[model samples]
Target: MADALSQFEHSIYIGSYMSGILYGINLVMYFLTLQGLLRKTNHNSPKSRRFFAIYSTILLLLITIDVAVNAVWGELMWIEGRNGPGGVPGFIATQTAAWYQTMGSTAVVIMIFMGDALLLYRLFVIYGSKYIVIAFPVLAYLAGLSLAIIELVIAGKPGGNFFHGKSINFGTPYYTITISLNIIITLLIVSRLLKLGKAVSRALGRDSAKMYTSVAAMLVESAAPYSAVGVMFLIPYAMGNPIAISFGQVWAKIACLAPQLIVLRVVTGRAWGREVITQAQSNVEFLSNGRPVVHASGIELQSHGTTTLGDAATEKWNSSTKSLGSS
Candidate 1:
């Protein structure tokens, strides 16, 4: 029985450690992408930027906290031992599980708050013309801030320690108000995009019309995939099975994160946009143009108002000139 229990712990620890490593890599990628975008206006959607900022900040904070948690789990409790690379430039293992888990739980709560903020921001951005732009962010701040206080203060050290372990339960509310709110928000986004699409499509012939239309289409297209995050996380939040639950939760986080990464990859470079086949085709054409040509009529290296002989002609000149000089 002891051996079986040890095996189970080992399996779970492996999953947790792998998840931690993946989380660290994801955070690094997000930070680099966010820094590059902030310096340049690569995207137009304010909601998107707001979400990126929120996501990047919260994820970074979580990465820090989890690094500590993984440390405690490995050295003190967990079976496999989290004794690999720290994944950061300089991270040392010192904190206790009590402290690490507490901080990590707090960070997780902050992320949920950010998710709510993002959903509401989407509404505000979509309805800015119809309503006050500041209202959404303001309301979001109030709601998230208040809930955050509840999570931080009322449920201190949420990782099965604080508030008689009420923190984890509340910290991870799945089928409750939070998840419902997310679903409703998703529906609202879909509805708003539908309305916005018609307006943008009206000016289809104009160059600018396509821009807004594309935005609307993209917003709509990405909505469903983004909502999948809610569904995945909410399950673990509500009735998490500890094993299957966390797997889904991590996947949800990745889903939320990957789209933004894809967007960053797309928006950053224009001339840098050619695929491998495209570049290969261009190179093929360029090299074929360099092939020998008898006629100099269609040449590109125009110099001194005269044509430079092609490869075939140059060869002929070398033979004739050499023979005459020898004579």
Candidate 2:
């Protein structure tokens, strides 16, 4: 029992430290993302800026509360309650159903929901807002949400424990469903991006395709790190390993961080947005004169039989080139 308690203590300490570091990184990303959204030079619609600003702010607040709760809980377990009753382990065990613990858990679960919802939204947009494409994912998301609610309720009961008893029955399935949803959405989004990348490449050039097909773009769009960490936590957690605690902490922070990164990409116009396909495909046209006419973002150019690309078309192409290169 002493050895087990020592391991739990070490695991939570490591998890807490890692969570703190992640929270710091999240703060930096949050500010940068917000700045990008609110920048005067950003040509995004007011609706887009408003939506991202609100969502990012909410995410920041939830993560901040989660981090603060964890700090207080750690202090109560290791510092103030160190010598009380059965010591640190006993204090932690007794506090599992405490309000602060529940608050932290609730914050993490909400963040997870937000992240998954964002992925589903991306999938919908990438697929041209087709309801059919997102039907199953939406169902899975609702199921996961139900399971998470049940798990939270169970954990808030008197003498409740997250890793033991009835909580595991719901918690395991919740994690499984949530992680599966993320994987499915990631695959769908990546496949769509790849297909579009090929079309764009054929129409423009490989450099232009980088906007959608680059490694960084795919990783951010797919929220791969969020799903990866979730898998890491789920495996160990299902195996009853104390190390699961550490991974869980990191996973919670990643839930917010991943979406923030995506928002950053969106605000900066590097993400795969609506109408990208149309924009790319409509850029090049072959005329009767056997010469290629260029169109960019609604600016159309006719080249008669000459090879000279007009100033307007050239400017638009250069702007697109800069955007692609930066992305």
Candidate 3:
């Protein structure tokens, strides 16, 4: 039992240790990217700053909690002479983790509900009709909270000397709730992106903007598969098959780390995107009398607009005015 426990213990340690390292990398990138975003945000505008505040708080708290509970707590739990209650099971370890666990509980509270609300806000960008009326961020909150509470209350209790290959088992359908939410949210976001893509295609008649959105959607889509995989990792742990689940975890690790980087990059690259937007091709045409007229290519951003620019420029100016080609 002890060896079986030690093996499980070591696997968990490995998983969390890897998770902590990735989280550290991601948190640093998030911070750097957010620093740039903060500089651009209108500090006085409540709406403009809300997302930054919320996601930032979550990332900060996640890092803190993960470090305190998973990393620090785990280390301390074993440090007190391995088979004994010396390290994390000791007073100092409990104190550090107890507070962070409480904070994590709070963070999860917001994430379960408010996070989904904030995510669905993007639906306004895609849907032209009443589809979003079905959205219930409040419901998401309630369901998520209920699931979290159920996990804590119903799961079995931890065994004696928590470090010596023994733990409390608390199995429930909590992850099912979480996974269902993932599918729901991913589908929502992808649907919105699709609609937004078509609208942008129709309005801007351009590819650059679409390329950006497509890349973003690709990044988002990449998440669902990986999330599905990562959540599976929890399943084995939750269901008492932890050893069978540990071998092929690279996907989960990459899934968790890569999305954060992609999101951070997009946030940082927003300025670059705007700069591209502002630099759309422009030209001035002249009447026979030499009066200047303004014309621009359709914002559609083809690598080469197959139509002749000279003729298109002349035609654009002509199309915009009552007097062009009249003289």
Candidate 4:
């Protein structure tokens, strides 16, 4: 019994420390990206700036709550003898512990959902603002959100862990929805970009199309890291590996960081590569007797023959619009 207790305690410590380190890294990256985004965003575009402002505010709030919850839970359950005196006999699921645990878990869930929503919105814009294209992803997202709320209720009711045993049933499908959503969105974006890049190469030259391919590659590369981390969390969790605890601790940090990096890359013009096109392709028009007429190729980006220049600051907006015809 003592040996088993020692192993369990050791696992908790390792997991806690790992989570702390990852959270620290997350803070650093978040701040850096926030600074870059603020600097590069067009001051004239109130809509874009306001959206980012709200995004950053919510992200900071969620992470702050997550960190605070973890600290309090650690202190109360681990250091302050909630697991019985001297931290032995493992966590005794009390009402207070349940609340703290549920709060932390919920915060992470909300943060991840926010990140996924941003990705879905990007997908909407990338696919020419077609609502029907994202209908399935939207349904899946709503289903996942409902499950997350259910899990929160369960966790708040004096559970040992939210992802254990019967709870695993809900948790499994929840993660599946999230993973599937991300994979579908990324795959669609990559496929479209590749197809467009090939077409551009044929029309222009290999050099011109290279930018499109590079941005596509960058998208895949940025998404791959956290997707792998999420899978690692899922596999160990399913198999009941103790290290799953460690992975779970770091999961939220990586979740928020993934999308932030993508936004930072695009907003900073890094996604555009070294090319400097002075004008937007969507800005191009043919003049007929002093009246502007839409260029045929640029018409794909329009919504009923109307285009807005205010969307230039966004990640998907810049990439999709510019790649279509920036010549």
Which candidate number maximizes TM-score?
2
lDDT of 2 at 180: 90
Flag regions of model 4 displaced more than 4 Å: 1-11, 40-44, 82-86, 95-97, 199-212, 215-217, 220-222, 271-327
* Candidate 3 error regions (>4 Å): 40-46, 81-115, 128-141, 153-171, 198-207, 221-226, 243-327
For each candidate, the alpha-carbon lDDT, in order, equals 0.45, 0.80, 0.44, 0.61
Question: Considering TM-score, which of the candidate structures 2 and 4 is the better prediction for this target?
Answer: 2
User: Per-residue lDDT tens digits of candidate 2, residues 117-163?
Assistant: 88998888788778999999999999999999999999999899887
Per-residue lDDT tens digits for candidate 3, residues 166-251, read: 22232234445555665566676565555444433333344634543566554443345544554665556555664532422333
Q: Candidate 2: minimum summed lDDT over ten consecutive residues — where?
A: 318-327
Question: Per-residue alpha-carbon lDDT of model 1 for 206-273, expressed as tens digits?
Answer: 35334334654445333454456556655644553344334533543453354444434433421111
Q: How well does each candidate superpose onto the true structure, as a TM-score?
A: 0.52, 0.87, 0.60, 0.72
Which residue ranges in model 2 land beyond 4 Å of their true spot? 280-327
Better of 2 and 4 by lDDT: 2
Which residue ranges in model 1 land beyond 4 Å of their true spot?
A: 1-25, 28-35, 38-58, 79-97, 129-165, 168-175, 205-226, 244-327
Cα RMSD to the true fold for all candidates: 17.9, 5.0, 10.8, 8.7
Residue 323 CA displacement from its true place in model 3, Å: 35
Q: What's the true lDDT of residue 92 in model 2?
A: 76
